[model samples]
Target: MFKKISWKWYVGAIIFTVSLALIFPLVGLKSYVNEVAIISESLMIVFSYKLMIKRLSGPVTFFLGLLVGLFWGVALFSLVGVIYNIN
Candidate 1:
């Protein structure tokens, strides 16, 4: 299963992970961090849709990615809020 998946999908995920790691030090605001996390999650969702499932139309993939990204963003934002509150 998944033998034909493109290498680009894995490459994109690697890039996102690297960027997410590097971005932590530059983030001074929680809002910016949340934005970055959501964007990364959206990209990953796109990669997932392309890799693990049959191709979907652009709008379908976009909406699915946005939905998943927003869910992840809310969780991330809540964690961030907790950390800020603790400090």
Candidate 2:
């Protein structure tokens, strides 16, 4: 099912989802940010796994991608929360 889709699409979708997760809390959806972040992160992990399974990415690439996503998402959320006093 994922073979026909270009890898670029996966990357784009993951970026979009993470962006949305970060944006929502700042836009007055603080209460729902947890849900959003969880879903977004899960989606990103799944996409990374798919890329690895397809041989479009290496195991190291997949691991680093998850690490990067985790740190980026948490850091952004913390910075935004601190700056905006959202939580």
Candidate 3:
């Protein structure tokens, strides 16, 4: 699955994985498998946000876009975690 994925998807996944590890650092849940799972989930959010962005057709679009941005932030963090091996 990683073979055909986009750079952004990979990036976003890693960010989230690291965030979770840092938050629960004492537990030290960092692992390759853990990172992969987090990355996978984060990518889904990013893709969802991308689809939602198209629905931005009016005043609420701005607000919705903002919300999507926040979602992207989260996905980015997960991607970071994967990159740093923080799971």
Candidate 4:
């Protein structure tokens, strides 16, 4: 499923995750959380596009990974906002 995603997507994900876990704590939103979420969703699209390119050997797995990643991004932003009240 998601295996089609380029390593770049994971790189983006990791960067975003780390930013949320580390930088978001100190800087808070300042409107940055939305940017982070957008980037995360973009990464999901990248994953999906890669899957499409592969003709989707395993559509479910690929879609599920994209979905999970998208949701994870949303959830991450929500969590950061909760602790830091960036929302």
Candidate 5:
């Protein structure tokens, strides 16, 4: 089953998930909005992890993508906090 999966699908999912993480902060400045985004990012992390588990090859690459997503999520939340502090 894992061999049947395409690399494009993995890449696309990662790209889309990370994009949302980066965009969420720019969409709103409210605390609730940020909380929602953080929740979504956490979900994305799980989603990506499941996908990685599905693949039989190159688990390291998929794990790295998961880490990147996690990092971006945390960084974006921090940025949102900074922006809120500035206002």
Candidate 6:
């Protein structure tokens, strides 16, 4: 189902999500930054799951996608925390 989605769409989504992660701090909502990261990461994982399910047609692939999403989520969360601290 997601086969028609272009790479640009994925890039744009990532940019939008990251921008949101950064914006919370800029607007003095620093406390909510972690929440935003978690929410965004969850969304990413969901998307990854759906995409993998549609393309790979197997439970194992779904698990792999979940793992990848988790890894990315943690990395993104750490990155946002670091940037927030740096500022």
Highest-TM-score candidate: 6
Residue 26, candidate 4: Cα error in Å is 3.2
Compose the digit string of candidate 5's lDDT tens values, residues 12-71.
665665455455556663545555556656655555565666564567756765785678
Candidate 1 scores a C-alpha RMSD against the true structure in Å of: 5.8
List candidate 3 segments past 4 Å from native: 1-57
* Model 2 CA deviation exceeding 4 Å by range: 54-87
Q: How many residue pairs clash (N, CA or C atoms closer than 3 angstroms) in each of the candidate models, in the order given?
A: 0, 0, 17, 3, 0, 0
lDDT of 5: 0.59
TM-score list, all predictions: 0.46, 0.56, 0.32, 0.52, 0.41, 0.69
lDDT of each: 0.58, 0.68, 0.54, 0.64, 0.59, 0.73
Which ranges of candidate 5 are over 4 A from the true structure? Answer: 1-31, 35-57
Weakest lDDT window of 10 consecutive positions for candidate 2: 48-57
Shift in Å, residue 77, candidate 2: 5.0
The worst-scoring run of ten residues by lDDT in candidate 6 lies at 1-10
After superposing candidate 4 on the true structure, give the runs of residues whose Cα lies further than 4 Å from its correct spot: 1-9, 20-25, 44-58
Error of 3 at 16 (Å): 18
- Residue-wise lDDT of candidate 4 within 40-74, one digit each (tens)? 66666565555465554666656766776678677
**Which candidate has the highest lDDT of all?**
6
By lDDT, highest first, what's the ranking? Answer: 6, 2, 4, 5, 1, 3
lDDT of each residue in 54-76, candidate 6, tens digit only: 56867877687778778878888
Prediction 2 TM-score vs. true:
0.56
Which should have the higher lDDT, number 2 or number 4? 2
lDDT of 1 at 87: 36
Model 3 residue 38 distance off true place after TM-score fit, in angstroms = 20
lDDT, candidate 1, equals 0.58
